[model samples]
Target: MVTDPRPGQILALVGWSGSGKTTLLERVIPLLTARGLIVSTLKHAHHAVDPDQPGKDSYRHRIAGATETMLATRERFVLFREHRSADEPDLALLLSRMAPADLYLAEGFKSAPVAKLEIHRPSLGKPPLWPDWPGIIAVVTDAALPACPLPTLDLADPGAVAGFIATRLGLR
Candidate 1:
């Protein structure tokens, strides 16, 4: 029944702390890209994130009240946006600022208005988010989820996870 994530839309890959979300994404992204998909990612941190070292010129610029700083080189560039308050930007605004891709993959935005693929590991001893969170399209788990209503995917098969996402996004 889940639909909204067509091509060029956002789909979140989310899980509790230490639930292998990053590890699974590390494996799955390559498979999706190998099949000729351009994926962009947005990672939400629960704690403070510092992209620059204290002594770096960009850091000094930010410390001197520069809200945005661009560090560029031949191969790539990085833009750092510094916030002085606790207000976290919403997913839509963050996604809009990113360059277009076939799919926008977000990590750890539990309340965002996007479809999600949940990574669940019962061994981690934490409660699953799917039962309470909305917009979970499927679950990738290492164990049985008898009570879950969504499609259950195997955690060991990153290819299958990639395929599911591709199919859901209508790109496969």
Candidate 2:
């Protein structure tokens, strides 16, 4: 399926560790938002991560076999749950749970259907992940890749990458 057009756009940033994907994304977010576009980020994690503290009621509920638990305060809230046997939810499910926004910036989930910008570092001893992944719309790399089918942006110029994204999504 294509990215949701309702909320504006969904952009993915994919790369190997230490290839500067996150750093570029971090820089791009503010620049995009400064132009009056709403933005949210989704980061894929391989390890168990709990934004809540241990021994808290919500944490205890999770450890006590509760399938789902929600904690709320005056202005904020969090929902926690554990999956028993089902596969982890995909991009659509995660996006569904988020508040509405003009754009969504996703990091990782390299295999998802979303259009992506891959960060490449030749010194990492790995070939470009682009040629095999046609969904990659662009590349941010220091090394030259002549036969690359995708547009190449300088890794040092975060603005250029952000501009490309804006152009691709037809955003200002």
Candidate 3:
């Protein structure tokens, strides 16, 4: 279990592509929320990404050299910022922009120094990350890995994973 996480503890779901990181988060978020914990998520993309659509005012504004653009309505709002340079902001900088929540679930940023649950699928044929990464506190896998030293949980069971997270964060 985590000893003393920074305020609004951050946990990451990290794994290679097609290893079910996002899929687990999709299940875990609702479970966490239902338990009365406010949750926020941050996703990192390796490729250039734009949420705005072409021919739209927001997209046009961005294309016209606006460094930042925001589209807002009563229902929701999206803020898009352009990175002129290739350097992406680190996790700490990005977390500062988010509203306060009981927990933060990050989908990517696997290399960052944060507590993470490694999701593994044997069929993916990728080696487990915990062997080289100390930040990986536990693992969620669809297949057995007898060599892994950390606590292992079933990937198909989100409740068990959520409970583990809550327990580790000292929320339960």
Candidate 4:
């Protein structure tokens, strides 16, 4: 029962820790890519994280006051930018930096106004977020959900979830 999402749609997978958001993405990304869809992912972290290691050339360049560093190889390239201010960039601004893709799957930013699928596990002892989160279009859960406005999918089935996403993105 997936509806057509807007062009270049960005969907968010949101849930509490241990709810299996990342696990689901690992399953879903291949399904979409195998069908010739270019999928990009944006992950938001609440804590400070550095993808570059210390003592690396790129790390040294950044530490020496370089605003940005690009590490390139024949296979792939990575661009790292440093933000010195307290304010963080919004989702739209960050998205503009990414290369063109058919769909952008966001791993966090629960309140960013994008359509989202919430992962819920009863074992986590947390209430369902879709009850309060207006942007949540569906819920993927292990336990049965009460009567909700959004569609619910079983957490054990990644194929079904991937199909749902493909239909929603109009890739089917």
Model 1, CA-based lDDT:
0.85
How many clashing residue pairs are found in candidate 4? 0
Q: Which candidate is the best by lDDT?
A: 3
Tens-digit lDDT string for candidate 1 (10-61)? 7888898888888998998999899888988889998877878998898899
lDDT of each: 0.85, 0.85, 0.87, 0.86
- What are the models' TM-scores? 0.93, 0.90, 0.93, 0.92
- Which regions of candidate 2 fall more than 4 Å away from where they truly are? 2-8, 73-75
User: In model 4, which regions exceed 4 Å deviation?
Assistant: 1-8
Alpha carbon deviation, residue 137, candidate 1 (Å): 0.8
- Tens-digit lDDT string for candidate 2 (1-172): 5455454388889988889888898888998998888898999987777897889888888888998899999998888767876587788888887888878889988888888889998889887888787578899998888888778999888889888888888887
Tens-digit lDDT track of model 4 for 32-142: 888888899999899998989999999999999999899999999999998888988677877888888888899988978788999999888888898898788789998
Structural RMSD, model 4:
3.4
Assess candidate 3 and give its TM-score to the true structure: 0.93
Write model 3 residue lDDT over 1-172, tens digit each, in one string.
2232355388988988999998899999999999999999999899977778999999999999999899998999998888788689888878877788889899978888789999988898788899987689899999988998999999999999999999998874
Candidate 1 similarity to native, TM-score: 0.93
User: Which pairs clash inside model 3?
Assistant: none
lDDT: the better of candidates 1 and 2: 1
Q: Name the better of 2 and 4 by lDDT.
A: 4
